[model samples]
Target: MSFKYMPVLRSRENEKRAFKNFFDNKIFSSNTIIPLIEIIQYSPNRKNTTDSKLPEEIFEESYVNEFKNYDFPIIVDIPMYIDLNSNIKQKYKDFLSEMLSNSNKKTPSKRLIYFNKLSKLKNIIPVVSYNPNAPYPLKTISTQEKYLRTNFNKIAFRVFVNINTITHILNEVEQSITSEDILILDLQDDDYKETKFNTLFQKIEDIKTSKKCKTIILNTPITEDIIKKNKNVQNDCPINAIDNSIVFSYKSFGFDAFGDYAGIKKYLGPDNNGNNYNPPVTYNIFYAYHQNKYIKFKSQTINASKPVVAPSITKSKCWNMYGHTHHKNCPGCIEINNKSIDTSKPGNWGTWQAINIQHYIYTMNDFL
Candidate 1:
């Protein structure tokens, strides 16, 4: 696959619609991508310890029937979506045993039964989500997780280590998860943008050297410096996948899944059946409305009531928008100035976002 972009499905409703879309072939015509989801407890007080807060509704008959519609591997994340809000008398494994067992039957000793049932599904590669809580170090949790994974057949299970935990408890993490498991990292922090690329590259290099997992950067906005062309290290790392949740983000912005826009609707393929362009449409020259480009996101940022302008939409500010744009900023200050984006293009916000996703995929391919 060409740098998989696994979109995260965070809720029951969100997941339901996404799965329906997948079954109907409304999105992801390409096999290179799949919907990713994290199992989480919706309620702060999860009274039902026996029931899983994750994989919330997928096991129901309706969802099982729906899965027969498509034949693509889903990158299922099994990381700890949030800390356990309530205390339990038994370990998580005990809870797992009860979850997969029949309503009247008890199988507290055979936890692998859960994995066996899940593994039967030919389309999902479940990287069981994990989080170690307050009292234990990551090493302990990692060891327990590995034990759980071993109960199932090798092909059925993988591990997803949360970035926050991995960064701190690497040794214990190393003990628990392997290079084969997926490590989830996100550069959503703006503070990270200020650091040298070499620093980040070195960190990635070290992680790759140690964990050696199929790595992923998730739910991050496309930034110029992160994907700037001509940077060799960007493509040299072991990072295997990425997900741009701009569509979901747009929905959060109160739009109805960006379906409101006609220009973008055409690209949201239904029957195209994975025709993500032959040879993978490398975004070189002629990418963004012909010629290289720069994009500066306008902001409504301020400190208190004193409005501060986003450096992006300014006269002198500059950013590396996938390519260098040493363009002098001025009024009508873009177009020619931005070596990547042409202001002359006719598109609304939705159209621009769709084009931007293309830009992201092509640019990230350089890293893969």
Candidate 2:
């Protein structure tokens, strides 16, 4: 919830470990080369609200120095990260290529990028990681369905649904109604009321009856109040119950199955006999949510990177991508709870650029 400064262990070693963990795990990637755009708000001039005297320059300098080694085509989320008054936009605003072009020194295209969904900026690609549970844009889901059927047969699909994202799920089902792939809908969280739950179940029942194979995964993230009533539905399968109040567990997997760090592991929960659950690490956060705070603070004084699609995870094989939080030039990270990180204070966030590439490249070479 709050932020703090922490330490960075041997920087290279820690980053290497993070990269290894990210790629080793099983994360879904659609077949398109959609880049993951992670963004964070970077404010260097504003000294620590806690300590105004601390020169912000030193902190930012250190931040950039730490990550400068990661040289790659970084798509900076420009709008949110840079000074609006700055002329980087005007000086190089002649064309789209100029916006991204880095060759001309006088008007070097700063990697800091920015755009709104409807903004008419060409060559500024939009990217998303797939979210199977939520309703999705028809076009996106249609594209995903085509890719899935082409590559693999009998794919084990999972979806983590909630009220907000349910629309996307409906869109996906509508798109997939004629497709050959089976869909396993994992309806997560406990906040929904009975009427809504039944309504959702009915919708699924209809889809299943008409569509290909389908299964329902139900979990109550706080109290298992709803699970008790709905466990017996013909299509519903109770997997696990969790306390949504626990920030770590909620972030780990509760948000969306496979969307968070410990998705499959937490969703499985304990065996029939209640006991300590120790799930294996199928994937780890190469960069944790709060880790981005440090990444941003440690980044250079240069303009912030504009947010773009996550290039690492979204590839030719990926259909759609999803994650929490967004900004024009977001440094894809956040702080939840008061845990102290080791790099800056426990409070700083680490924004990323090219780190996703570390895992993405590895995934393409090793897995695909």
Model 1 C-alpha lDDT per residue in residues 257-343, reported as the tens digit of each score: 111111111121122333323222122111221212233333232333322222323332222332342223211123323422333
| CA deviation > 4 Å runs, candidate 1 | 26-31, 41-69, 83-116, 132-136, 151-168, 175-180, 186-191, 194-201, 209-212, 220-368
- Per-candidate Cα lDDT values, in order, are 0.36, 0.29
| Cα TM-score of candidate 1 | 0.42
lDDT of 2 by residue, 1-368 (tens): 01111011111222333433333332212221112222222322223446544323332443343234332211112221122233432321222232334422333222212222212222222221233332343454344334433433333233445656765656565555443333434434444334565666566556656664433233333222433443443211112232222223322221211111121111212233433333321111232222110010111111233222232222211112213222111222221111112223221112122233333233332322
Question: Candidate 1: worst 10 consecutive residues by lDDT?
Answer: 257-266
Model 1, position 51: C-alpha lDDT score: 64
Q: State the lDDT at 123 in candidate 2.
A: 23
TM-score of each: 0.42, 0.26
Which candidate comes out best when scored by lDDT? 1
